[model samples]
Target: MTQTASMSQNGARGLVRGGALDVLRFVAALFIVLYHVAERAPVSLFALHPALSRGYLGTDFFLMLSGYVLARTYGERVLSGGVGTGEFLKRRMLRIWPAHLVMLVVFVAFVLGTAAIGLAPQNPQWFQWSQLLPQVFLVQAWFVPGISGWNMPTWTLSALIVCYAGFPAAWRLTAKVRSPWTTLAVGVAIFLAVDYAALAATGIPGHQLPLRFGLVRGIPLFVLGMLVARMPTTIPSRLADGLAIAAGLGVFALQALGRFDHASLALLSLLIYAAGASGAKGSAWASLAGRLSFSLFLTNQLVAVVWFGAQRAAAARFGFDATMLWLTWALALPACVAGAWLFERLVDTPLQAWIKRWSRREAAVPAPASEPIAA
Candidate 1:
């Protein structure tokens, strides 16, 4: 008999349990929470010192993974012509907006409630209508003044909008790949061109990258992911394994020595991607992270506001020395997990479900045979 099929899409990329991707996402989210907690805690907690902080790395992982997952989830649809501009925007809105709106409302309420109880420090100046409207409209991302949003936690939503705004063109361009490498080359060229063009113009590519791309910075990373999906076996295992070891060791050594900056950090990021792309199996932990990653990214900040507040209050009540910081991080783990669960069920889950329901179709359209997703 032919070899048994061990791997499968298993249909629909909806939250499948026992996945390594989800687990990784959860861990990334957990790190963000811990990072925030440590930052806010007393320095007496030497173990929770800033030196131990690699929390922001979580965002890097997220940006890289976003491209990868979107390729897996939506690449087929784009190729098949199932996802059109209208349907594309609709589905994306379904995926992100409902939960987003709910979160915004919750954030506002929490702030107001905390203030009501006199638990939160008053910054009445931060509560201006001028800044509030842009955030509610999700346009605050374009408005620096609105960056101080009461619900300023919606940066991803804004970044995503920037990404997908160009999705139709990206799909059309890659839709004509003669081979995997051809498509990969095209995507890589775009990223490098954009990367260097900004540099050539500003004299420093990486430094100018943020100002040049701003919200669209995630697009190149996202395209990196799409290219990975298009060229599933671009990097051989042995070479990738070596690269992974080098990258991991480099990151650890740098972090250990506190010498890693943006340049080294970028290289370290590339290494992480190479390693992750090499024969990545869906481990249980990764699955957990992938499942909760979206929630974690979006929910962590919301939950942290209250959790951190309570920690601050408690530390104030008792005499918490710097040593208490690490303990605060320890306490944050359970609180975040529990909060993520509740936030998911009460807010993220239902909102996500409702959005999905609104956009559900009886069949998924495939692209024309002349322009297959992997033609």
Candidate 2:
């Protein structure tokens, strides 16, 4: 039986529930939040701690994890036609779009409210009207010019949309390659080819592809993830644990040494595989954190905009000290976490539930009979 059938037989618990992957998801989300905060903080956190500069690797990890998770969950169904492509895309959109649209609206309101109060944003170019349409359609990352204004991180969403659209074909192609080693080889080759082409053309590595063309960066990492999912997990749990530890340490060591090379990517991939294979069923807290990871990621930018804007205004009014400024910047992290929890509970959950209900109703209703055309 396939994994999906097994899931159905076992109450739909999913393959990676309450696992190390969940903890990693939460950690990745937090690091991404920190990276953004470090970028915009007034005191320059990177100077004090250069490791914060490596937070962008969270995104790389996420792209790969997404591929792996989707492959494990849906690859068999997709390959066997148990889930049609259209239905799969619909499911993906439902998962991602609600939170994304909510964030987009919040950002729009933020920009308009700031304008109404005669307050100019620190970066006015990021709030341009020209970019709104692409953002609304979630196509901002598809070769669109100019910086991703509004919520900057939503560019990942745009890239992921393209990945989802192509996933059926990617799954089929990867499934055809029986040898996991050969699959890994193909994925690495694609990643290196894209990396080299990006370097040659734009002086940027594949992993650092600009927001306007994020699909270039997203696709290979996603494929790599799918390939990783195909690999056997026959090692002992203790061995998996050791490899995970080493890979995690390796990633940090490379970052500490200011090296962002293929070695780091290799370590990340190893870390993911080892963590998954360790069979560590995490606690409820870890599962909750995993559930909140998406919201944390989607809301961090908006939280930053509001949190820092208010901090700036307060500092200008009250003349904050260095200690006070740092305190407020530190506070933004938890504020982001709280905001994500609230958004997920209040907005995304309710909206998705309603969409699901409406979809069920639509499915229940019968279609009108077709009339015969005039001869």
Candidate 3:
């Protein structure tokens, strides 16, 4: 199949891929996977590492990255009328929803099959119609309570769909801001205000809230990301490296201190900008990881469910101690990476190409003629 055209219809093709951003995406995805498997690690080690516990903030990292890339790419196309908002939405939906729906179905089927064999699926919400309907429609993050229903990680996808739907208007509004710093400050303030309000109400860090609250969790960072993309400030490589290191340290400190709130979001924005500013220095490995990261993020939880279930079964059969859990930890990461790579090759890539082919065919069809009134 032909490559996806440039995000802007008029711009040159192939701006979407490569750079340090790819490396960052891969790392963020890996962090999230390890976060999910943290329970398998030794209690003392897990307790000591705040970064691993709060690693779910990796999703927030993804949201910021998404906002930056989408704004830099599609934002321009929509604003310039090079691509209609409807077309933009269609393309974005094509990029995300097919794979999401496929996995959603797979999860449901897996649950049912396990139930048939007399094993109760771990998450009961998967079978509830009330919860399943919203998730199937990709609005679970807006209304669901825990938001970890079905494939839990998809809360990000649901929130992202909302963001994509609003991108045209958001981009228009963002363009009106004359000063990039003001835009950046406003975005940061909105995030902090929301964080403060959540803290005051619940006495918990906002990022610790249910995944269903991902709508709130995602928006400010997303806005900040877009503003970062729009920023005129360009730090030299030496300074960018320093800032990146500092920001990385800041992220660790925030997580370590259990301040998993807007500070985490702010630090993530800085890290992404430091890595992505100017342009990405592309490499084969980084590009491969970037290509697989989405599939990895989307599929890992399902694989973990199966893997952990097997580990439990093994523990039951063999009477092993905590070592089995640690064994699962040793194996799970590579399994996830391999599984995600296969999913990308077998499912994600071909499904995307098929949709693109169908889209082209639909676009080629002539519109029906309007009827004239009889004289």
- Clashing residue pairs in candidate 3, if any? 19-280
> How many backbone clashes does every candidate have?
28, 0, 1
TM agreement with the true structure for every prediction: 0.73, 0.92, 0.88
* Model 1 lDDT per residue over 169-288, tens place: 676677677586787677667766766766777664522233213454456656665565554434565676677677657766776677454544455445645544455444555544
Off by over 4 Å in 2: 1-14, 367-375
Worst 10 residues of 1 by lDDT: 1-10
Off by over 4 Å in 3: 1-16, 42-46, 123-129, 145-147, 233-235, 253-261, 278-280, 321-324, 371-375
TM-score of 3: 0.88
Q: 1 or 2, which is superior by TM-score?
A: 2
Scored by TM-score, the top model is 2
What RMSD does each model have against the real structure? 6.7, 3.8, 4.3
In the range 1-375, model 3's lDDT, one tens digit per residue, is 111223333332233255667778999999898888787564634676656666757877888888887876666666777776676778888888899899889888988899899998655655665578787878888857643567778888888887888888888887898887888888877877887777788785455557777787777667778878776434565776677788989988877677555667778888887765523346678678898899998899889888878877887898877776677667989999998999999999999889889988987776667853211
Candidate 1 wrongly placed segments (more than 4 Å): 1-18, 44-55, 122-129, 143-146, 175-216, 234-250, 257-286, 321-326, 358-375
Model 1 TM-score, all chains together: 0.73
